[model samples]
Target: MKRALYQRLTELYNAYVDTFREADGKLPPMMELKRIHTAHVVANARLIAEGEGFDAETTHACDAAALLHDTGRYEQLKRYNTFRDADSVDHAVFSHDIVKEKGWLDGDPHRESILAAVLYHNRRDLPDGLDALTLAAAQTVRDADKLDIFRVLEHQITTTDWRHNSQAFWNLPTTARPNPVVLDDIRSGRPVAYQDIRSLADFVLIQVGWIRNGLAYATTRRLCAERGHLAFRRDFLHQLTDDPAVDELCQYAELPTQGVS
Candidate 1:
């Protein structure tokens, strides 16, 4: 992958998302949210790639994947007006389709593996035995994506009430008590699944788990820590409930970055 090609892909992504803008040339809030997010994910990917000492082409591939990872979200919103995969389409798979159909990565040397990263990013598990290049791209984008999402969640909840950010909160019931399954998932060092999230607190708790075990790189852990993502999530949960397990799960986040990939 060439840096020039990556730059072209970035331009293409920007112009594509521009189609979602309203008459005033302002993207709707949700579209703007994702547009900003993709930018930061690319920035975050750059940090991780540099910290991990990736070679030039590998960094190029990872950055391209990061920029294009959410390509389908704009189309998904236009078609269904919802980000919920169950309510509409799986954004990740849709993103892969859009990028492929557009031939954005057509001549890149590592096209297939980069596309695989985009395709499998939202899945619960990646297929085992991926090539080193494919694994690098996939892990970089996933880790970068999750790390920034914690920031986005915290910002939306803090700047506005959950009632106003229904898209972010997914219409979950307001409750102080988190679902036992979500707490148990964290307690056992497992990432919480979407179906398992009950209250808004449960959703935050799942992101907290990402700090502990879900991150694929030590650099990601350090970036998340530096950004205070864990502290915000932990503090939010503490305000919501007196559950002692909140502290227990948070302690895991403080532990040294566990076994970076």
Candidate 2:
């Protein structure tokens, strides 16, 4: 069943790629992002499920859910030309809507939960009362998604051309100082603010902070650590330790970490 599902998924992905290329007259802005990132999502999700000792059936659900999590981004971007979900409209909701409209998910064995997972994966918070299966798939996809963002950003920081598209995401100033949100998040061991991030370094750390908050599976965490982002964790902490603004944020939040050396 898993093998068959995988093959079908590959075919669907191939079609999505063809359609995407036709729409943009080129691949999406990032290099091999959709293809490589989707593969990472599936591979990480499978490792997460296997490490958690999930049944084969659950693993199948997770694999389908992870690969399809961003399935709507292609259509959404083709229409809107931007990846900001809130600005273009919620991509997750758009994904669910498009899947129904196009009947792309019709008759798939894991269709219902895969749709549910894709719909809920990028939410600011998980919905109340999610069933175990749905919740597991959602969390798996979220972790895998964030992990791949870390990889993409890590690559961007080193590659000049990658940084060009990345810097344009929020229009960071070339002369901007370090983003204070980066300092505060590290001090509190939380994720950084999304909107105010203003540099390649800040971008990379925010991606790192996702592990500090979004990770749901031990396998996901272990893989992130193995990727050497664990040290980046300390880099943020070091920023917090020295920055007064970060100390102030801690105090304002009344978090215990605030004001402590």
Candidate 3:
């Protein structure tokens, strides 16, 4: 049953990608970026599920949720020309609606759990009282989603040409300094809200700050270290900021020890 469900999900994902493929056999850069990111999240989700010793059925459900978690991103980019939820619609809600409207999970026995996971994967906080199965699935997707985001951020920071993808920088000025309020939230061990991000430096600080509130599994932390994501972000932040306070915040975040297993 798990194998069959996995196969069905692969087919659905392929069809979705086909929708965005250009007639000339190319996807717009953003579409391709998201498509590839979704693939990584699926792989990361499976790794988390296996590390957690989930049964085949639970693992399959989690994988489905990961694949569909960003289904709304493509549409959001097309409709709003941006990925910022504040500037546009909430992508999570849009994804949940698309899953239902398309009946993507209608016949699955774990449909409710899958949908719930996708809907809450991007939320600031998961609601109270989610059933154990739903919570596990949601948390799995959330961790996997965040793990890959670090990979994306690492790539974006290194590549350095924002012209092709201004949205990736949230259109904040690259020269702008970090907002103190945003820094305070991170210092308090909380994830910074989108509204508080006023500049590229604040954005980077929030990404580093995610280490405090975004992680959901021990295995995810190990994976972040193994993938060199933790070290990359730490180094990138050091290069981007000269303020001693930002350095202290990075230290407080425990930027992962370098060369330590």
> Can you write out model 3's per-residue Cα lDDT over 41-87, one digit (the tens) per residue?
99999999998888877888899999999899988988899887889
- With a 3 Å backbone cut-off (N, CA, C), the pairs that clash in candidate 1 are none
The TM-score ranking, best first, is 1, 3, 2
102-189: candidate 1 lDDT, tens digit per residue: 9988888989988999998887778999998899999999999998888788778878776545556877775648989888988787
Which prediction has more favorable TM-score, 2 or 3?
A: 3
TM-score of candidate 1 on Cα atoms, chains taken together? 0.94
Model 1 segments more than 4 A misplaced: 163-167, 257-259
TM-score, candidate number 3: 0.89
Per-residue lDDT of candidate 2, residues 1-261 (tens digit): 677876787687667667767455777665247667888888888888887788877777788888777777777777887777766878788777766676666767667877898898887678889877877878878877887776765565456543245453355543344576675675566646676676654654554445555577767777777886645534543443454543343233332222111
Task: Give candidate 1's error at residue 167 in angstroms.
Answer: 6.4
Clash list (residue pairs), candidate 2: none
Model 3 ranges off by over 4 Å? 162-167, 255-261
Q: How many clashing pairs does model 2 include? A: 0
